[model samples]
Target: MTPLPIAAPLTIAIDGPAAAGKGTLAKRLAAHYGLPYLDTGLLYRAVGRLADEQGVDLDDAEAAGAVARALDAGAIDEAALRGREAGELASRVAAHPPVRAALEAFQRAFAADPRGAVLDGRDIGTVICPGARVKIFVTASAEVRARRRTDELAAKGRTVEYERILAEVRERDARDAGRAAAPLKPAADARLLDTSELDIETAFRAACAIVDQAPH
Candidate 1:
């Protein structure tokens, strides 16, 4: 039996580990193509923030899953989840199978919209939007990503040590790659972009080329 085709519009999935520039590229791609852009990590971040606000233990999978299920993106305060602490909590919550299951439907629904969308997350290409028109797995070395993250935090007036940030980045990478539920990896048909040496503009342009060249 043949699977039914995905609905119209070009859904783009950009995935990567922490600070790999996937978010930046996704935003640019969405803007260029006038599609809705979603940084799916924000979904988990919102959940983590809820767990923290409600004093739930990060290790309690049931609690985390509950928060994920009740997450209201419209009500989430992105500014509240912008710190390093929120990111760490998000990583822990994201490992819970139930939490991932809870969020998967929301992600799939957004990707299925006919108006088109660009979503960036660890599992976007592999899980959320496998049939997307273009899938890009954007990544860079941990050192490079850490440096980028450090600069970003500094610009945002957040104080964080580079060594500490780097350690956290590597730890998160291990956790994401080793997790049993939707482990972070590129999709079979996804294009890989190593932005270790490329600037944001260059990386965006490279991604644009990939999207432009993909057969509609």
Candidate 2:
């Protein structure tokens, strides 16, 4: 892979809510900069999946925290996590303060790696990497986001009603934004990218430009 053109190693934190195109932008930025990308959402999904596997109640804060604390990145199955149920469960688990705290060290270590890294999630900038050299908050209209998600799921042969998906998206936004721990708001220093009208490539280019111009 070509190396990311950077004066020195640093973390790039991308934060946004569901279906906001933050994931796509982060992945492309990582590739362009030759950095490893971490979908921080995956960590929550791992905890939620593990908790469900062990028959723990979704609201059991202590058990959820313990599961998150012991989560091993090696155990995560990205494909399996794409399930709608898993995502909903993950969001619920992620609202737990302990669960978010438990994963902070892992995220910090990844950010401080010599090779550099890019992380994307609901709070990557607000909490996970507040000091990150480049912080991007990607966002889109609720309707547009829901439509994109519906299309993606349909392409994968996963049947889901569009209105149901839109409702879920709105519900998730509310939960994330209302959470007590590291709520889903852009960091003060972050550059907000509203991709409501832009395509993936265009949004990515805009994100990369922000990263390129940010002071290290």
Candidate 3:
């Protein structure tokens, strides 16, 4: 991979709520800069899916933590963690402190790479990589995010209701912000990007500008 124009150890943390485009933006930025990229949220999703498969109570902290501890992040079936049910399960499991603690080391180690990496998740900026050289908080209105998610699911041949998705989006926002462990919030120094009115290309350009302006 080609190195970024910036200096070494240029960790970039991108944080946001569901369907806000952080994942898409992070992938694009990672490609542009030739950095390894991680969607940290997938860690929780995988754990949640595994716990569910094992018939563990979704709200059981110990059970969820066990799943997280035993997780082989590389072996997670990404295809199975792509829908609303997986998202809800992930949110519940992620609320457990033990679950977060179990996954923290892996995320930090990835960020510690000398070649740098781009990580996107709810707490990437605030908890996982507070000292990252660049941080971005991507967000959009709940309605807009819900529409995006609904359209995405529809494209996949899944029938979904906009109202239901909107409610879920709001519910997730409240749960994420109110959670005791690593509650979702922007880092103090993170640049904010509201994609409610921006297309992917426009959002990508804005994110690129933010990274370009970071002190290298």
TM-scores, all candidates, are: 0.93, 0.93, 0.95
lDDT of 3 by residue, 63-160 (tens): 89999999998898887898888999899999999999999999999999899999999999899999999999999999999999999999989999
Local error of candidate 1 at 113, Å?
1.1
TM-score of 2: 0.93
Give one digit per residue, the lDDT tens place, for model 1 in 40-106: 9999999988898899988888988998988887887877787778888889999999899999998
Best by lDDT: 3
In candidate 2, what are the lDDT values of residues 1-216, reduced to their tens digit?
998776657689999888888888888888899999999899998899889999998898888999998888887889888766788888999989889889989988888888779999988887878888899999999999999989999999988899999999999999989989889999999999999999988898888889879876
Residue pairs with backbone overlap in model 2: 4-33
Candidate 3 lDDT score at position 65: 95
lDDT of each: 0.90, 0.89, 0.94
Q: Flag clash pairs in model 1.
A: none
Model 3 regions more than 4 Å off: 1-8
Candidate 2 local lDDT, residue 110: 85
Better of 2 and 3 by lDDT: 3
Best by TM-score: 3
List runs of model 1 lying over 4 Å from the truth: 1-8
